[model samples]
Target: MGRKINFIVLTGLVLVCLLLGTEYQYLETAQGIDSGDTAWMIVASAFVLLMTPGLAFFYGGMVTKKSVISTMLQSFVALGVISVLWVVVGFSLAFGDSVYGIIGNPFTYFNFNNVTVSPNPAFSETIPFLIFALFQLKFAIITPALITGSFAERIRFRSYILFMVLFSLFIYSPLAHMTWHPDGLLRKLGVLDFAGGTVVHMSAGIAALAGAIYLGKRKEPIERPANIPFVILGTGLLWFGWFGFNAGSALGANTDAVIAFANTNLASAASMITWIFFDRMQHRKMSALGACIGAIVGLVAITPAAGFVTIGQSVFIGFVAAVVSNLAIRWHERTEIDDTLDVFPSHGVGGMVGMLLTGVFAKDVGLVYGETKTFIYHLLALCVVAVVTFFGSLLLYKITDLLLRMRVREDQEHRGLDASQHGEHLL
Candidate 1:
């Protein structure tokens, strides 16, 4: 009876918060809202939202049947968890009034307070501020979901949830604030991330490495993927959604969006071809898995430079990133650390390659344009992000472990996370 009462009270409190957010209004009027830009942004936001489900299939098809359900759930659950957190506080911490150029003042937009239907010049001058906030929310959702692949099949579901919350609060919000906020430290320093090479992919990839190390190796031997068809299907969806992911960052239906859209497809194609070629050289056969991974590496590599570089430069970035990530995966295999899906090699290395290449190839400000200042700033920002994400992730993992044991027991692992953790089975 007491437990039921507590649950009721908690539910009531949540309802009240929602009510307050809905009734709230900002009286400020935005100038020159464009219908075309608004329409494009709405579609783009939906496109970005779809990537989480696409990622579910991408990781789901790679794990054993016994863990398939659990693996996919990690990505699916983030849509719900992060979405609510974003409306409540995550958005404020990321884009609210800037505090010392490091983070947003959480109270400025708490529970969606003052997030107006009219445009905010700080983010987008032509779209509703609410729409811009929602668009950014999708990016936040996927960033943590990206980490699940590293610890799949071994993480306790409850502990994983707790860790996701912590990671979102401590690691993701600050990075997003520092990179995307108008007055952010990195932004002020002239460190350019056209999409999210550093903020999303690099942070997720490095955290994946930390999670894999902290959890140690899985006791069970790695097995062949249960379903390649799912992987292919996922790859297709991710590729489709990426158009919005890259182009939508432009915040308008403009030339930059068009350029980003074209560059996205070009880079992905080049990377896929290069990856298969490498496979043919090493194994004498092209592979579907190789093609999909190569395509994803290309997408990841081009994300940061999508709007800044030309189609030709994007192709070059894709090819180079594929080569580097493929080698990183090979090197990772030899190490004692077990990163289940090679998230770090593919995302971490790919994002780094994109960031560096952006400094070299970006229009007007690139090293190729005889400007070294932008390149030097990018290098400095890369080191800062890499160091902060690494140590911060390591600390978060430790704290999560202390509060809730991160690893499942041996018997639970043998039974698999789906059946043991959630009482479900894939096959």
Candidate 2:
């Protein structure tokens, strides 16, 4: 049955690609394109793409040795799955014509029909619209990859692929539309997400929580990181790629990008330092794992405010977010909910902190600047996003499970997902 289903899907995808082949002829570079900006954006897109494999390492190293291969593949597969999906209809569903400010018309840029090399002034005037779409594609890819951590080691690989597609289409695209699109509901309401604190990190984190809850506990919930060194390597790659993640959102080689770059570094540094010291204060050892997690939390917290807040404010945001998320992890340990790798504590809570602080410290519009409206809107948007992502993800998980069982069999769980699901194991 699974083989038949895979064959049918593959056949349909091939037909769709053939039908869309003519659309590629429309691709042409337009005048008024800035070479420098275009170069930077291309590099930025590549940098963002690298983060996915980096994520694979980051996640793989955190799971037990028996599950390492399966865990890493979960993140790695998104590169193939989401890239194709985005080109097919995911990009349109995100950046296409706004449909009532909540979603995009799927036909607006169907199969890259009008997504040409010409700059779309609405997105970025200096770079090709195709580049813009691809840049956003990287974000779409990573969001679902991030969720795999919550259910790692026990999820059936095929079931997860289905869930990833559903999550990207239903959850990720709409949120991207509502947060980043010019006609987006939240954007019009004065919400300021310079990067993806809300759209990517928050949505992934919240959805991760739903997944962990829906999937329940792994049969063996014990965690013994497979390789701490891989965690360090992944952290380094993520930190390096994040400059593009935050600064590239500026859409140009401009002052805002420079400011964002500086803020990104400062926040991560402060959070890393704060996290280790905070552990010391609690009589815990300052392990390298903690440092890596702390740096990531800082990155998540700083994302939304990177281009909007001052350097000093970014550091403060990182400091506050690290302490809060560290506390969140400790609190989570008390619950029966098993979120492998603590995705909710790190990305979810960190994103929330960043979103709220962006409201407080955003230039000229923050609470500290005496403007109440933006801050109020941010609070409201945060609630809306949380409710939408959590419940929506729960629904998607249910639907996916109904279509195909989501979890592995008990024996398979005991044997580890790498060998059971993929028929392969790490050396």
Candidate 3:
């Protein structure tokens, strides 16, 4: 019944969009747009859009059966919630005219006012600004969705929704503006984030860590994944979608895009191999879970450096990230905090490592080229991101709690979020 209602609502929305007459009105610019670049960007946007559902499966598969629906719903809902939010004000906050280099002027693109079919050379020379905005909307949608993994099966849906809105408005917008906007502070400082190592992964990962700490532990923690095959399937989807996540940052079908695509695959393969081998050496047996986690860690580690580093550097980045993240996960297991999906280890730590490695291995401007300036700025940016996300998430969590209790009741938790929160259960 609920699914039917949702489907109807979505269908209505689509029909409305169609009826309103969506048309491409290209603004005249001195620089002409390229069809090839536009076509690739169109495909790339779809690829990036697929990742949220891919993440839904990945996170959904990691939890017990009872919480599966709720967990998956958390990610799926972001598609609706953030998509609406992004168009209304989120895009302007993220990519509008620069305001003191900290945020975009909301009025600049409020309701996507000036966004058109023509290229915005300030952002991309070939792709339409609307396409670029939509591409970025996908990123905004995924970042908050990524946090659901940490506090899965425990958090209240209302609180999560509120927090997602607040986080998007406050945390994500500023970071995106500072890092990606031409006159933004981080971009001016020469911070290299080809993709969203700092903006997406790191921000989500740190916020996850804060939530995990705040939420404490699940009453009865399940050590084993409920469905290994589901996890494997999710991992495969995530891997497939990641090409867009990394390469699509190039915003065109060019050399940088090609390099990013190749680097993404190579790094993931290297990390997977390294993770299983490391597990075999340490525990006397390789685990499928380790392989999946390693693959994701590699993907995260390579994102910031995807277009900046050489293939060899990408392999190194993946291998080292796998090792470090593995250790971080192991250490986290021994602690009291319950990060349900090891979000901090895999994404938070991997993103940090990737950002640092980008400083070290980036072509022409890396530490290897004696460019200590880029390296130092990266460190500073990492610290700023860490502090902002951590504290900001904490504050948002508290505010959400005040408005609506942040967690399900103890009884509801024991009953499982699927039945308790969604009134559904896996048969």
Candidate 4:
């Protein structure tokens, strides 16, 4: 979910409600100190922002040196591309007032009619709406960027630009509504993703699969990572930013936020150690890349449950999610599919694990307003979304491949995509 969940996302919008579900004239009415939560949110926002660059480094390092510049360019591609789209249309299409449980109506495109800075009725209605829009925009920006890695070495720049537009406008917007909007199908089914397990991470992972299949594999899919150190850098920066990703979901400086922050740290630590221990036992030496991957798995696992579960529960969630994703990725390697970054097994499988565990581990964490049969609903929702996302992704990949000759030609692939597609050399 490392797009995380709605815990903070939901809490930050409750303009008319109080801590105890009391009708409140002012969310800041109590101590009048929005200082702590507001300050934390400010920091959390930065953390989340940093993750995008971190992702660029992570993905870029995995591509062949010849394609390094092209790979890194995708991050730039997302930064420039999604930012404008979010402001002009993407925001309204997602968070706009619902239109019968479909896409959100464009109630405020181009900041149309000057949408007020009023707080949403969902959180505390204290944080400004602009803040909400920007926060979610950060999410929107990073997601399509995530998919770029799968197709990194071969996709035509023009085709990718077109795909990005359609993805944000058609695919991302409605899906966001389907889960985040009040009447959304997932929400209506009692699904509780505090952030974006299904909406962002799962969806991106699926789309990554689609993009990979459509763009086809790298000219040489077997090329080792260009810089393992860069992978470590990617892992480090991502782990650091995740604090914001999970904790910021609370959107305020509260106990829930603190719980999220701590869980993010702990789960990653546990996962890193577990992967090192398990892999070292199987092989002779521990691998830095494996540990970093383990840490990422930990981050993905705790995303849905960061605010919902106890610390002890967090350890369990991280462990289980890592182990499952690890096994799944190994299984994936034996197949014909060439996911350059293994986004599906890692993010997709890990996200499913996180979302389902959220159902199982959600507790009466005295912080949030309502806490119910936490785990079961999460599990069911995870299964349903996984099925939909997986099948939907497969169809899209097939259709796109059929129409566009998704994969690079074998001759070009043998020559390396950077040279084959771009008429340039790596250096």
Best by TM-score: 2
Clashes of each: 0, 0, 0, 28
TM-score per prediction, in order, is 0.96, 0.98, 0.94, 0.83
Pairs clashing within candidate 2: none
Candidate 3 residues 1-427, lDDT tens each?
4356457657866764564364435455535788888888888888888888988888988998889989999999999988877876899999888999999988787666677888889999888888899999989999999999999989988678878999999999999999999988999999999989999999999999999998889996866667877778888988888888888999999999999999999999999999999988887478888889899999999999999988999999999999999899989989998999999999999999999999999999999998899999999999999998899999999987877688899999999999998899878
Cα shift from native, residue 341, model 1 (Å): 0.3
Candidate 1, run of 10 with poorest lDDT: 1-10
Q: Tens digits of per-residue lDDT for model 1 on 168-253?
A: 98889989999999999999988889989999999999999999999999998558997989899989989998999999999999
lDDT of 4 at 269: 91
Question: What would you estimate as the lDDT of candidate 1?
Answer: 0.91
lDDT against the true structure, each candidate? 0.91, 0.93, 0.90, 0.72
**Candidate 4 residue-wise lDDT, 1-427, digit = tens:** 3123224435533531232243323333333336566567667778888888888888877778877766766666787667767766688888777777767777544432333355566544456555667777777877777777767767655446546666777777877877777767667766667767777788777777766665554546645788888888988899998988888888787888899999989998988888778777767368887888899888888887788888998998888877888788889889777788888888878878888777766775222326454455666666666666556655655554454455556776666656776677755
Better of 1 and 4 by TM-score: 1
Q: Report the error of model 4 at residue 132, Å.
A: 1.0
Worst 10 residues of 3 by lDDT: 19-28
Clashes of 2: 0
- For candidate 1, the TM-score is 0.96
